[model samples]
Target: MTANSPLANPADPADRGHLLTEQANPRSAQLDRLSALELVDLFNQEDQLTLAAIAGARQGLAAAIDTATEALRQGGRLFYVGAGTSGRLGVLDAAECPPTFCTPPDLVQGIIAGGAGALVKSSEGLEDVAEDGAAAIADRNVQAHDVVVGITAGGTTPYVQGAIAAANRRGATTVFMACVPADQVPTEAAIDIRLLVGPELLAGSTRLKAGTATKMALNILSTGTMVQLGKVYGNRMVDVAVTNTKLRDRALRILCDLTDLDRQAASDLLDRSNQQVKLALIMHLGHLNAEAARDRLAQHQGKLRQALEARVSG
Candidate 1:
């Protein structure tokens, strides 16, 4: 390639070929020769490593959960930053939070290198721009109470690294998630989560095992944080937004299972509570009207169990 080519960076000295996520898997050496069923079996075997990787990073994940929960409790926001598949996964998780936990849209956000367009089409070339990542953080007005999570499978994405560095300067709690080890790619994040899923089955394709592991980690992080925030009651999504028929049915079922109400009565109560399962439960269990139940919930910080317990003890 010519030195003047836009893709050529002759002065850049970073070499990512040695990263664990970039290595070729010996078991997949004969990938092209495998039968369809064999390929499926081999993939199943390799996927087991994703579970082990999650287990290995359990402590770090828990720490991130705690940090994020505390930040949200204090009115802080959670932001996930990345590029490519990692970025799309972050955006997906952030988008699901509102419907599942009745959170505000801005409470959890996703920042990709090329913005929303990258979620569908490939804008991988944008991942190389460190300044763009830093600018994303600045534009968001990230503050000290915010939590910023930087996800990069190879742990060398300049965009993610730049965002983390910018977050640190803004005094936000930073969490870094990667498939590589610290020895290979270190970070200044408050919490470092290494999935360590090793090489991909397709040789350097991190969208495979690494992507799965990241989704699992994000599931735990977001769910655990919401639980700590009192969005759940007895393992049920109490704060679930009844935005559709399916969610309304789930809310009704939760009421029937948790309270003495049957299907019809639960449906009536759900309507009375403005389709809020938690509020309906509080109204029934605490013997309060809709307004009083809302007051109790506000007093108890939206914790259904705490609101009921305080009423009983009173």
Candidate 2:
């Protein structure tokens, strides 16, 4: 090849050679040449890898759940930090915690590089600013009790790396989620989760398989933590906020299913407990008034099952 040609001999940095997410998939070498149906079929095949990737990371994911649950039980917060599509996914997961689990808004937060404005636009450049990630951690006053999860699809986003380091210095537990091998771009987090779904169908576009895997991982992390913290009871969102018609119906259904009460009776019980499903269930099963059931729940740190057991055993 000519010296000026694109194929001319060059030194490839270690970072450039090891990233699996950026590699071209042999299966999709002719991605652009495929028919519409072929492309759809290929995409579906690639997506299946995402689930397997999560399954592989089960141990690390469980560790993350434990760390986050312990931190939250100690009155600490949970933070999801990432950039671009990764950042948006973190933000979406954190946003859902409030209504679904009745958590305070500040209990779980998402920090995206380039701020909230970057959610809609391409803020790719900001991911390289490692210092900003550290600053974002400081901005939130992350402490020893908090758990911060840093997500990077290719696993080398400097911003995520920076956030993880700062979280370490602050004594907060750090969990790292990436879509590449640990040897490629290690984050040295307390809990390191690798979602290895191989190369993207469209080359370096991680928004496909990598994005889905990351979203599923975050969902498991947050939801599992909430479950440990007693936000759920018997597969029901006992702490769900009845903010709308659908949620009201769900709360009523949970009551009826658990207590075998008719619709009117369940609705009345929900009102008596101030529309709190957990309190309503507690009051019914423990054979106590709403105030007494609430006291028991508080004594048991919001764990409904334990409170009911204590009431039964006492």
Candidate 3:
């Protein structure tokens, strides 16, 4: 599969020292000599670059969100592929989707080079084995409908690149995220998100600025996609899972805030909807029973706004 495909070409790891992320920041030349307070201040100043980098990649980020939302709407899954810190961040974002948006666990997944064990330990060495990444994609049975996001701070992790290549072969939509310029480290992904935060304060330690910027990007990508998927309603997470006391309290508050119900009434409404915040809101607003409200929501593809609008139009 790799012989003719342009996306399968391996990046030349030779002389990667010239990459912008590998360069030392002139401003941080005396980092070790700084006082404790000075070090804190310097880190704070450098961290601001992460925000700027995110802003710079606004278009790419928006494109990714749109692609992922549409794919998911069509019953496709979203996968984040990376290694080391990047991998852990992907897993973290994927894990939060279920509790935050009430999504199925498989709807969003994270694949690291060394699997679950790598999340806690340093499996950085596995990042160099390109085949492992490709095998991971095949293991997931990635298809044309899925969206695979490859993350590598320096733009040259063989593991991430391999996963992207394999995803492309399986006709999946591919997103490549890195902190270097395309000229420095090119990729054949459908969308390229470059978080150009320059070099880290500790020279090649990308876990500093690059990691911060990557985390910010991932947060935006996941949250924006969920919002577009109708998991959010007017800035509220309507699909939030009510699994514990805190979430039940939050669900009650949401009911009260969105409707005329008081805390006690909201709790009753929540019980009527089986603790589903979206269904409870629909049941109250649409003046329908729990089953009817659930059917309406399903007919509208789980969009509370659409379901309610249908009730009004009907």
Clashing pairs counted in every model = 0, 0, 0
Off by over 4 Å in 1: 1-14
Q: Model 3: per-residue lDDT, tens digit, 41-101?
A: 9999999999999999999999999999999999999999999999999999999999999
Off by over 4 Å in 3: 1-14
lDDT of 1: 0.92
Clashes of 3: 0
| Candidate models: Cα lDDT each | 0.92, 0.89, 0.91
Candidate 3 has which clashing residue pairs, if any? none
| Best-to-worst TM-score order | 3, 1, 2
Cα TM-score of candidate 1: 0.95
lDDT of 1 by residue, 1-314 (tens): 23343222211435677889989999999999999999999999999999999999999999999999999999999999999999999999999999999999999999998998998899988998766888999999999999999999988787887788889899999999999999887778999999999899997799999999999999999999999999999999999999999999999999999988899999999999999999999999888899999999999889888988888899
